[model samples]
Target chain A: MNARARLLVFALGALLLGGAYMAALSQLAPLGRGASAYADILNRVCVRERHITDVVTAVNFDYRGFDTLGEEFIMFTAVMGAVLLLRRGKDEVQAPQEDELTSRRGRRRSDAVALAGVVFTAVLLLFGSYVITHGQLTPGGGFQGGVIASTALWLVYLSGSYKVMRQVGPKPLVEAAEALGAAGYALVGLIGLFQGAAFLQNTLPPGSIGSPFSGGTVPLIDIAVGLEVSGGFVLLLLTFMEEVLEIRLH
Target chain B: MLNIFCYSIAAWVLLIGLYGVVTSRNLIHLVLCLSVMETSTYVLLTLIGYRVGGTAPVFADIPVGTKAVDPVVQALMLTDVVVEATVMALLLALAVQAHKRTGSLDPHDLRALQG
Candidate 1:
């Protein structure tokens, strides 16, 4: 359909949807007055039973861990599919790939931006790792931290350190990390099952509250998720860069 | 009655995003419109779970038994964001591949599937 026709249809649909949404809003508890018994229970029991300071982390990695597991694999499969879609076809010439390498040599490198990127990469990595490891303690968790860490991987390229970036996170290494992350999560749950407890149970020692060792399997699961997300995104960035570079050269 | 503001904002965002998607000629823009719609969902979820005087669900600093907004929806939002990112990346990749095959980024021009 033409653009105008499509807009007309959309306007009609929007009106209907808006009306339905307004009708539904009344059902929602007023702002900041919503009751969540489940949240209340988790908030109360998490620290005492799971030794987790962050109830969100407890729910994600413990109570509803299976959901996170599914989410992680969704990410893994999406990355894999993206890479495949972006892959150089069999008949595609390898000439443009090498052309980009030589072209980079003649390109102007900015010392100021390079310095800034270097500083940013270091700080982002430190903060990201802190977020990753401190999931049980803080509101941040593996997914949040992993994405932050992945931006650090991007900064390595941004700072005119493309060669170093490639050296640090090659496809094979990133693939392995991503795979291990996906597998490790499943294994954590399996360990619970093998122990005759419920799958994804808080199987590990609920380490002493407020300590790094606390939250039993939570920290372990968080680290694995961190690896998975970071690796997956790095792989994604690398694949897109390669494609874009070839497009630019050709 | 004033509480409707947050939900109204969410609804407005959703409608705007849908309008963008309907009018979008470029695949990348359409994908972004979808992300905008997802953003509306996140807003709605947070608004639904908001509690008066609630702190964050973490008890690391606050004393125990402190009231906090719902953690469940926040957890859902986290996954929602990650999935959206990866899915957006995948969609963009597909767009790239489509362009490579058809030499066109305009959705209208690419409507006919070619083997």
Candidate 2:
């Protein structure tokens, strides 16, 4: 189509969309004042049942835990798909000699960059652990913390050669940890099942609300999810990096 | 008035993303446009969840009678964000493979499947 016609069509489409959106917005109940169907119920029950301060965590891991399980599997499947798509094939030429490739491509390490990477990695790892463990008490949780933790591995890749990264995090070990993390989450849910409760039921005792030890299986699920996310992200990065390095063939 | 503003802005963002996707020549640009659409949804949900004078829903240091913003939408948005990230990563990976196989990033050029 001509540019004029295309622009006219686009304008018409936008106008229609705007009208539809306005209509929908007009029908929506007033914000903040509109009563949620189950907010009050959840608010009352969540604190009492989970004894957790962060109601969001309670909702995610307990109230709607089955949904969270599906979310975890979504991540799992996406990473698995990435691995399958990016894996080195039989026709791809493997690096015959690691030392030769390193000597050829590896630049002299910058002390400043290496030092900064190490400091940042350490800080991120600690913060990630804190976020994952204290998920029930704080605003952040496993997903956020896991993404942060994976950045440490990314920094390792940035500051050092592939060889150093391999030494620090072997591919097989990371993959296994990813699988284990996903499985561990499922296993936690199964415990609820074996206890004659619903899947992902909060079987363990929820301790005092504010303490780190509270939230029972919530914290454990958070840890498992954190591990899975960190490993998945790191693996995704490694595969792309391998492609960049020509370690994997086109 | 504030609700109108927030909702309109969200709609505008979504429309802009849609326009970009419709006109995007490159796959990477299309992916970015998709992200913009996702972000618009996030903004809409957040705005919907906001209370006029409510504080965060956390029980830390707040008065007993103080109103707090809705926590359910926040929880849902959290999961949505993770899903968006995963989907983006997968799309980029597929884009990489497409480029490797076809030697082009343009949707027009990637017409092998077209009948």
Whole-model lDDT per candidate: 0.86, 0.81
iRMS for model 1? Answer: 1.0
DockQ for the candidates, in order? 0.85, 0.59
> Per-residue alpha-carbon lDDT of model 2 for A1-250, expressed as tens digits?
6556766798899999989997898676676666675765666566667877777887888788889889889989998888787767676775635663353365676889889998998999999999998888878778889989988988887677677776788889889989988998999999888989988998988998788989989999999989898998888887776766655563
Error of 2 at B25 (Å): 1.5
Angstrom error of the Cα, residue A105, model 1: value is 9.5
Best candidate, DockQ = 1
DockQ of candidate 2 against the true complex: 0.59
* Predicted candidate 1 versus true structure: per-residue lDDT over B8-99, tens digit per residue: 89998998898888888899999999999889999999898788999889999998799988999999999779878999999999999888
Candidate 1: docking tier: high
Please give the TM-score of chain B in predicted model 1: 0.96
